[model samples]
Target chain A: MRVAFGEAILRLGEEAEDMVVLTADVAKPTQVAAFGERYPHRFLNVGISEQDMVDIAAGLALSEKIPVAVAFAPFMMRAWEQVRSTISRCNLNVKLVGTHSGLSASDEGSSHQSLEDVALARVLPNMTVIVPGDREEVKEATEAAVKSPGPVYMRIGRDEDVKFLDEPFRIGRAVVLRDGSDVAVISNGAITAEALAAAEGARVDAMVIHVPTVKPLDAQAVVSAARKTGAVVCVEEHSTIGGLGSAVSELLSSEYPVRVRRMGVNDTFGESGTYRELLEKHGLSAPHIRRRMEEAAEKRDR
Target chain B: MSSAVELADLRHATDVQKLKERIREIRRSILEMTSIRGLHLGSSLSCLEIIATLYFLKMRHSPHRPRWKDRDRFILSKGHAAPALYAVLAEAGYFPKEELRTLKSIGSRLQGHPDLRTPGVDAPSGSLGQGLSIGIGMALAARMRGSRSRVYVLAGDGECDEGQVWEAMMTAAHLRLGNLVLIIDRNGWQLDDRTEEVKRKVPLRGKLESFGWVTYSINGHDIEKIIEVLDSAEKSELPVAIIAHTKKGNGVSFLEGTNKGHKLKLSEEEYLAALKELEAKPVCE
Candidate 1:
């Protein structure tokens, strides 16, 4: 996934003279190394200064440059004020890329894991938030981001080998992986795979909604998907407050009030562990999602 | 070409007297804007001369062409001074001066602070101390793009308290952004208190110098002197910081020299008095 991001940026740099990359001293880890090396003049490494990185990106946008600032998900929120005031309010064309999202940064401890980025980022006006599930999705999503106007918050994970099934990707559109009438498991990012796995194990007919765009969300599609399934279960490797589950809940409550069982980290940070261990500990694995889905489906039937 | 001839030509081309008239028009628009939608009237007052100098004398922009790519970039780092920039930008014909009446109104492009959504504004700023870093980015972009167009940022002394400003300074120096110019509005007053008591920047020049920026200090209210220094920074091959010493409430006598004048809603009587005080020709130009 990281390599895909680098390749997409490299292509963007060739076409868009104004396309520049900035790292909060996290380029190498974020897989922006190739873009940095190829375009040294355009790459800026403001060592460990996330706040400065955001402000500088806004400035570059002011000078008619397309600035892409890269960092970990947690650090992106650390400079949240700069993002709100400088980028969003200014309507500067800045692309904020956060790597190592959710439990994807397994073993890096809870502090490095960002489970609440989507919830907070979406609340800000004029910010488009995206979380691609795998390598192919990352490439497609980033390319779409470069063409889109205004501010964007894109989240990618640390895992590189996750299978990215060949599918058309567009900003703010949900990809329905299956058709089902009993239940729908809506998910994003790394948890999309888990949602697929959960659907396979479900006793009743189930479907998966792979929504990459969390903000300026496809409300109509999500509501339609919910109405079809009758019961919905939102799965993610993020917090329940403001991640995929929360957004789905907000939409459902206002538009299509449906029963939703949210399967994610419930208000607790993950401890240091392997990816699989963390998933099990936080009840974010396929089994947990399946269990939650079955329970919600039974309740809906009642 | 002789240096004296070039200086004389620059002055003649700038047309200082015509610029003064434009400043009056800007002031009138600002007053009208405040009457329609009250904003940072006091902070706006503090930066009038600097705004006038940049738009009229320093910057290479055509009022007819606000989106000209090669024109010098200007960011109001002290976003609270939006009223001043809006006034000047309108008078300079970036937009119709009538749009000034929509200052801070709902659905109006004129936000409380400088925002790019508004025409002619490069970046949005309300959070203090981040504009400088944005300016550095613009400066660096111009350098990498091999454009001679410069980036100028006007920062408030009070905003220097933010640590991010220093971080931006370090980045700018490290990059040797010769096309960037920083003009600090040393108005001495901030929101609730004097800058010295709040965050003493007594050795501001020394601090910037140590950070590898070539420095200049001038009376901000003096349009001619400011024009000279600004021209120098534009021509220089190193990032320069011009500390413009200024009064908080420059044109209005009663509010001048006091921190209390930073943000206030003048009474009907006080508003008239302020206008009367400003009716007289400025002491320096």
Candidate 2:
């Protein structure tokens, strides 16, 4: 999923004349260094300065340039204030792509892992938030982000490349991978692959909906799915406090008033472990997703 | 947001007398605008002459056509100095002088800090230590487009305490952005107290030179010196940082170099005296 963003930058750099790529010293890890190598003049490496990268992107945007800033998701949050004031406040067209979102940082421990970027980016007034589920979506979302008229924040995973999506990607649109009336399992980001597995692999008879755009969410699709199933299971690799879970709950409770079970990290920092172990510990693996889906389905019968 | 593109037409100050008169008018406007809220008085007062010289003489911008493609860009990194910037911008016809009274009020285009909502503001700024980085971005973008336009950023001396300032300094030097210039308003005072008292930036020029910039130390209030340095920067191969030495509250006697100038805590008598003092010819040594 990380390299997919770099591949997209290479493809788009040729067509988009005004596109400028920037990274805060993690160019190789985020895989944006390929663009740097291909077009040295268009790429900027603000060594270990995310705040500088963001404000500089704002400056570039003001001068009729589209700057895509890539970085580790956790460290990029260091410049959240800069994103708020310099980019989002003024509504500049700067694309921000974050790698290792959620616990994908894995053994890099709690500090490197990011579980709150979705909430932070979602709350900003002018930012469009996207969390791609697979390698293909990361590339598609990166292209869509640059096409967006204003600011965009895309959260991508470190290594989850579960490529199940075969449909055309569109902003603010959800793709239904499974169809059922038992319950609705809705998710964004890499966890959507797990949600799909819970519905398809386990024969759970639950509707699986992949929502790539968290902001300007596919509200109509989500509400329709909730109304059809009468129950919802929200899954993501972020904190359940204010991520896809909060977004789903906030939308469903007001619009359709369905029973929603949010499955994600319950507001605790992650611990060091293998990626699968951490997912199990945080209740984000496909088994946890299946358990939550079954519980929501059983409770609907009551 | 106007789509109209026009050639740059600027009215340069013909002499020192004209420039000083412009500076005096800017001070008067700032004094009147901050009467109610007393917002950022010392910060505004310190950078008037530098801003005045730029708008009247140095910058090539079209007032009526603010988004003109070929125009030079100015960013106020020391955004608390909005009163000074607004005064100069209005004097240059970016917006009406009548709009100055709406500062800090509800529904005013003018905010406490410089906002892009206001005409002629290149980038929105209030938080310190962010402007130089923005200037570098603009400078690089212009070069990529093969345009000769330049970007100027006016920052405060006390604001150097922010680590991002140094981070931006490194990038600007690394890029060798010849189209960018940074003017540090060295008024020797900040909001908390004296800059050295809060944090010592005494060897500011030496520090900047070490950071790989072509540094220049100048009397910030001197119009001719400001013009000379600004003109000379165009030929350089690297970014330029100008440390402009100035007094906190330059025009009025009681307010100059005093904490009272930081924000307007003046009594009616002192306020009238300030206006009367500004009515005289500007003191340029």
Candidate 3:
């Protein structure tokens, strides 16, 4: 996902002279180092200063420059005040991409891992949040964010092992990856790969949906799927508190009432473990998601 | 260029006495804004001459062409001074002076702090310690675009306590953004206490110098001196930081030297007294 992000910006940089890249000393980890080398003049490495990086991106956006700010997912919130006050307040066209999001930083523990980035980004007024399913979608989302007007926040995991199921990327639109009518299983971010695995293994014919754009959610897609299946189950690599589940429930609880169950970290912090182990421990693995889907199917308001 | 303003028309751009009048006029406008309500008067008063010198002299801008690509950018890093900036912008004809009274009023474009919706406001800034970083970004962009424009940021001394300001200072110097200028309004007071009392902002010049800035200490109220340093700043090979020593609520007899009226709705007597004080004296003695 990080590599795709780096490649997408490099390609876009060639076509758009206004595009500038900034990183808070995580150029290699975020994989933006290649672009920095290719376009030295258009890139800035403000070491360990996320607030300055975010504000600088705002300033660059104000001057009609498209600035793409990348950093470790957890550190992006270090500049959350700047993100809210300057970038979102002015509604500037800056794209912020956070790599190593979620349990991908599993071996590094909770301090490095970000379970709340999606929640934080979702609340900003003008911010558009996307959690791509894989490398292809990360590239697509990166391109879409820069092309779209206003600020965008994307959370991508460091897992290169995730499956790439590319559906055309558009801002505020959800993609359906598998078709069924029993229950609608919605997931986003790298964890959607696990959802796909779960759908294949589950006995119930679950309709799987991948919502890359978490904010400005595709209510039409969510409501129609829920109406057809009579139940909805939301999953993410983030905490269930304010992520996909909360977003879906908030929308459906108002627009189309249904039995919605949330699947992810249940209001707890991540501990040191392997990437797969953390996802399994946090109930984001295929087995956990499959069980949730089966439970929702049996319990739906029939 | 045909759509641009005629710089030749602004004679006050060079004359010191006329510029002094310009500062006085801006103060009167800010007082008018205060009449509508609020006591952000002290910080606004503190940075007058520095702003006046830039707007009337050093800045390459046109109120008629506020978004001109080559125009110098001025950011009030100490955004509590929005009233002062709005006043000067109106006087420069960015908008009607009649709009001054609508400041912070519901639905007014003059937000309690500066926002781009207000004509001539380059960036939204009520949040402190942010202006300098924004200025650095603009400077970096200007250099990348090869535009012959400079960026200026006016920050409050007490506002320097923000770690973000120091972060910006370090980065600006490391980037060697010589095209950027930061003027710190050393007004001695913040919300309800002295900057020195609340947090020691002294040894400030030395701190900036150690951070690799081309530091200068000057009387912030001296328009001519402010102009001199700003003019010389263009030739600097590193970013410039000017410590402009000033008084809070400057030039007003009762409000001077104190942070009492940090934000206030003026009483009729206090309003008349402040207005009469400025009406009597056009410039500081």
lDDT values, one for every candidate: 0.83, 0.88, 0.88
Give the DockQ (C-alpha) for candidate 3.
Answer: 0.78
> Chain A TM-scores, all candidates?
0.97, 0.97, 0.98
Positional deviation of A60 in candidate 2, in angstroms? 0.5
Tens digit per residue, CA lDDT, model 1, B1-285: 699999987766558877877777677666656655556776787789888888877788876776787888888889888989988888777888788878788898788887766778766777888878988887887777777778888999999999999998888888888888888999888886889988799899999999999999999987878888987886676789999999876676776777655555566676677666667766333
TM-score per candidate, in order? 0.94, 0.96, 0.97
lDDT of 2 at A91: 92
| Models sorted by TM-score, best on top | 3, 2, 1
Residues A169-275 of candidate 2 have per-residue lDDT tens digits of 89999999889998999998878878887786654579999999999889999999998998899898888888888998999879999888988889899989999
For candidate 2, give the lDDT of residue B258.
74
* Model 3 spans with C-alpha error above 4 angstroms: A164-166, B1-14, B282-284
**RMSD per model, one decimal:** 2.5, 4.6, 3.5
lDDT of 1 by residue, A138-163 (tens): 88899899888999999988873576
The model with the greater TM-score, 1 or 2, is 2
Off by over 4 Å in 1: B1-14, B28-37, B282-285
